[model samples]
Target: MPGYELINNSEKKAVNEIFDNKELFYNGKRVKKFEKEFARYIGSKYAVAVSSGTAAIKIALKCLGIKAGDEVITQSFTFIATLEAIVDVGATPIVINVDDSLNMDVKELEKHITKKTKAIIPVHMLGVAAEMSKINKIAKKFKIPVVDDNCEALGAKWGKDKLGIQSDICTWSFDNGKTITTGEGGMITTNNKDLSMLFREYRDHGHQNNPKFPRGRDTHRIYGFNFRTTEINAAIGIEQLKKLNFIVRENKKRYNIYKKELLKIKHLKLRRIPKANIPLCDCIIFSIDDLNKIKKILIELSKKNIITKNVPDAIEWHFAKYWDHIFKEQKISKQQLETKFLKSSYYLERSIAIPIFVKEELKQTTKKARELSQIIKSFV
Candidate 1:
């Protein structure tokens, strides 16, 4: 299998510096610096660092006053964290279908809005930006806020604006697999001062003034959780931020290479992205009537040490069997807004994520992807 590695010694040196200083905590100066750097990077007024992407979403929901019985509409075809964050904030997740690009279907979003609807979390799936202009217009008509789940799309843009700048609250992830890595960290960006302050408090355990003091000693402004990002992680993030533009450019280059090579095949279908947007990952998906055949081919590739696996399934259906009781109680319904829900079906058994990272690896991976596409087309 082609190897994939997410770390470089250059990043390790930054993390080492923080550890040398013993600034392992997530409070005070280190966190502030990371937040400022990230905010500037995304062109947002404020950025709050959190332990994970889920924490960032939960904090955003809490700041927005999303509570139990409240409904938050989001794409069905996303990571479970997107829906889980809604549930974490005591709001019901109303799953909406996605377009061909694997983003929330803006036209169908209006159907899900109701008296109980509180917000819309548009996820930029597989690094592709959602149709934010239309989604924002729909949210405005209902007077609901938008929490952009841009976990997969850190450097992605919509028109001239960046992802987080266009929404009320935009959350990003820096997990090991993301475009950028901070080991494990997330960021919440917003222009709303009140929301930004609330998020800071929420991430640090709801302390009013002195976060160091015991719970009852200081003012307990609100109920909160310990979702702060560590200084070590922040340091790693600081370095990661420096390389983000380079990483995004590399990912895009790899995407184009795959697109150029694979488009020649008749049966394979690549994910579509607008020329203006920057994709987060090169996720190539296609349709196949026989899933077992695809699996067999992937296994054969695995023997050669080429890692091939299906794309992830939609959060709703993946968890349906386990969470059916809660889903039924909440009255969550599924909507299909595309000719084929390729997002879910592609994830089920047919699609695979080809290796794409650095320029050198990307070249090799792109060549392999085209070769694999030919292998699959032969079956067709």
Candidate 2:
């Protein structure tokens, strides 16, 4: 359900405005406006735009002073960028298994906590929100910060509020495949003023943005890096932000068509969604208890030219169990990695995630869902 599908004159006009001014660099006009709009939309005090979601995570970690010897805990089912950012900050990534919800298993969270544990990242994988209340409670008990990775679950909700605004620091991706697309960009949101300022400076190479001085004479508080986004990306994002509600609405309609049909098939367990979660409806996933049946369903789907989302198709990249090459650098053996993520493997292997397109016709979606159900029913 990428916003790229809805790209039209609105986005073209926004980009054109940037070209009209001939100011492509993000000198806090378009980028700052996008940040303000996004923060207001999510009900957060502040937002910092960055180069990409990976950069957002890295900047948040840096703002919190996470460094060597410190461990950051995240779910095994998350994208590798989560782990990559932790490692990039010179920290150890402590991966924990996900439960039926395909999110961090809160029950196993405390077991991984230690003196070195500096941050806990609970990723709202796919379209559903993780058990944020439970995860946040656990993190509070350990006195560790929580970085909500709402990259894949943008526009999703936990209880009454939006996903990213409820954590110590939240990160989002506006990449090509995301709910909204900016070609490639990211955002970090937080209520803490100090952390917000740090994120702003850290992403801009430590520039304090002093009103009295020019960019050449801007003072620095600490060493930073360039993670800035161009005005074109931000301008497109501003237009995309206006269409968020429409995207979510259409996604829900199509997702429900699939869900309604799938529910009629006995023994096909849908991915476990927590009661508090109001998903973005961008994707629907279900697990088949029989591995052979799962394979057959996939074959049938392939025959129809329908593609599954990340679950089985891109599991190798999304699941940490297959990241032995990365763990090898930390002296962790392949066997150890597999053993740690056994439960995650069990749930993810049997699952099939279908992408929901915002522009797809409902009748077509219903026809496909019925076809999909029949294929699964035949296997059962």
Candidate 3:
């Protein structure tokens, strides 16, 4: 319940329109329109709509030329999707510690770069922003392309620009819980024409936008996959994008309320959200120790039908250190493994996300939040 969603006549009309139109099926009709709107929304030259955020990351990595033997540098504490995309591209993920900013430690980056370090993926974990300025400067010096894993940070900002614009390639999700939704979908944005062309060709099964081989006919220009969005999803996305600004504004109000109410419970410490960044604030999160105590509080809260997540899922998968699959497969050195324990647990294990969804029935959400806070206070 810690997510925000608002749907009305627009989504219904979108679905009906798609169902009525037998002429416009899925050959990039609605998908292309949504992509154009999304690209314009983020001020990017191009956008390639895909099946999910994971697909966007996969293609972004492939477009960056990361291969099986290459090493990709990314934040240690993030959703497993970041690591999944790295391994999907056959690239070894070199996870580094997150500093107080709750992002990849830029200081640790230079030491990890080598002949094998091909690219850097700065995952903007949670709604909070990652430190892209310093990371980008270091990346420019080394000439390694920075692919922003901006899935969790849609509609987020840093300074005058949006989070995705600073990097070489950026990805977004319109999943059920993201700031925007098309049921399930993703988009990749970039300023580079070559990369844009590659993304298009890759997404469309290497067709190369040729007249000779149309939809029914085929000529494999390059190896690719069917990571395309349907007309139904794109139609919903187009309508959803229209309401994004208002949605963000309303959700910010809800987030502020949560922050104020929860801060009164001082023992359950809340992290100071960064000033330079304007986060989507889709889900309210806080840090707490004593997992058992937190678990007990959650049980009490759930009795009232209130929901909260345990440290962004679990301690093992939430933090990269305990990723047994990557640790076994990625060829992480002994030194990197040794340094993992030395890094500070900045946020992941110590945090819990509370349900703060956007609601038309505002009184109910607020009342529930207050009740959840009181329940949590009792445990403390």
Candidate numbers, best lDDT first, in rank order: 2, 3, 1
Which regions of candidate 2 deviate over 4 angstroms? none
Candidate 3 lDDT by residue in tens digits, 257-352: 788788888578765555678877776777666767677776786687666543545556557766666767856654666468456454555567
RMSD of each: 4.1, 0.9, 3.1
TM-score sort, best first: 2, 3, 1
- For candidate 2, write residues 154-223 as lDDT tens digits: 8998789888877899999999999999999999999999999999899989999988999899999898
Better of 1 and 3 by TM-score: 3
Locate the minimum summed-lDDT window of 10 residues in model 3: 341-350
- Write model 1 residue lDDT over 1-380, tens digit each, in one string: 00114357766887787678876664457678889999998899989999999889989999888999899988756777887788877888787666556667777889889999998998887667888878888899889999999887787777776766888999988887677778788999999998998998888778766668765687767988889888888877887778777776776677677777777766566665666575665354544546776676666666556653225324343322234444665553333222234444444445555645554675586677667766666665
Give lDDT: candidate 3, residue 162. 76
Error of 3 at 298 (Å): 4.1
lDDT of 1: 0.73
Clashes counted in candidate 2 amount to: 0
The alpha-carbon deviation from the true structure for residue 97 of candidate 1, after best TM-score superposition, in angstroms, is: 1.4
Identify the runs in model 3 with alpha carbons over 4 angstroms from their true place. 1-4, 211-221, 289-305, 310-317, 331-346
